[model samples]
Target: MNFLIEENRNLAPYCSMKAGGNAKYLVQPKSVSELCEAVAYFRSRDEKYIVVGNCSNLLFPDSGYDGAVIITCGIRGISYENGVITAHCGDSLSSLARVACENSRAGLEFCYGIPGTVGGGVYMNAGAYGGELSQYFIRGSFIDKNGEIVVIENNDMDFGYRHSRLNYEELILLSAEFSSVEGDRDAVRARMEELMAKRKASQPLEYPSCGSAFKRPAGHYAGALIEQCGLKGTSVGGAQVSVKHAGFVINTGNATATDVTELLSLVSDTVFNETGVRLEPEIRIIK
Candidate 1:
């Protein structure tokens, strides 16, 4: 399998937050087979690498990464058979929901505006409005550290509040299947549009962010806690808690990874001090 290896590539553009440095080596796989080949190649060469898809919720340090960054965004495909939908790791979660709606299938409407790919989504068990991927997720294929493909079922995913076995495992997702029941396409689309409207109204979509900045504390909303502490519009360098949504720490044009991390820490501390609820950041802070 032929592939290109880019060196000294800027990593900021790859992340949704648009705040990062550079990578020493980068491999973008164009297909699942290519992804497997790339992983095997790197593993055999004893080269350190980190797999990423979409980079929506990831924060790369400004100092940059010295090893291979294996990006799966180019490996995308989706299909529907009977009541099940199969998607490549690089497939967009939003696109998956839309395809489900198109096939007259309900559920997954909450994924409409999510910016991550299936690999990232499943790794974190992404959800919204009480809808979670684990609900419909059946099983998936992953590439182990040895470069061998392995299958894991829903029962083994260990899904819980934005957590999954992918958190502790060395495997990387390749593809997954989901099941959805039949529904009226019109109603499904309408519901999706309504949710999107709400998102636009409530989120700081005009600024680049990692969606929500913090996980919701048990019986408490992260945003409300930040808002209650009068932390809205707070800024650390170019990173600011969104005035539009206290839950988001947005990059105000020139934000750096340090700025974002500082702002996140400040918000979490302030919220905890005032509300007694320690907020755990949802963003992945990568070195």
Candidate 2:
């Protein structure tokens, strides 16, 4: 009951790519209880619904979603005790890394600049600079498809390269716990800064785009292959393969959902034809 709900909510602004149509109904719950209440309410009806975080890696269709879109970014919290860190799903990965640094904990330096929320990060097994959330992950709580709360242990996480069990399951992530080790406070901060610098230099952060357009295929790098095929800077309307980083498809100020999707298809097809390796999109296309 304690949440914001609206009709015909525009989703473009919420999207990292700044393109998308809208949601028939949008819900932003401020707490886990409210999230569950929203979920239950929607589940009780024969309505379509989805739980989202940050909209960082999602692409809503141009036609708009005809359902309730529950955004979890409003629910956030973090804490550290006895070498263990706990964070709510809505807490940003950057905040999680900062909490670890302030507590003199290491191993989370790679998360310093990740734009995804805790839930999204864990869902995708997000990683960078040879470090992944799964390496430090302990366990998490979630709401099942039936709206029942459950705790899944570390052993049950089923984490893989850029994936987790949550990818296939209709479960809603709530809060998660991760483990860390003692480290020099200054050293941890320095590491975080180093990674952030690398990110800024390599990524096309100046424009709106899903962080990485394609997953690395087998033993080859997606960006390198794309660039090798001379697909960088190629555009389909306002969506273009970033010249700075071929792995990203950026919105050139006025891109639409159709433009981005068409560009993604073009790039993937081109890459496969030239390199013999099919590129799979990393962003979730929600139609």
lDDT of 2 by residue, 1-287 (tens): 66777999899999999999989999999999999989988888877999999999999999999999999998999999999999999999999999999999999999999999999999999999999999999989999877779999878989998899999998889999999999999999999999999999999999999999999899999999999999999999899999999999999899999999999999999888987999999999997
Decoy 1 TM-score against native:
0.98
Work out the TM-score per prediction. Answer: 0.98, 0.99
Model 1 clash pairs are none
For candidate 1, write residues 248-285 as lDDT tens digits.
99999999999999999999888888878999989999
Per-residue error at 278 for model 2, in Å?
Answer: 0.6
Winning candidate number (lDDT): 2
Q: What is candidate 2's CA lDDT for residue 44? A: 88
lDDT of 1 at 111: 87
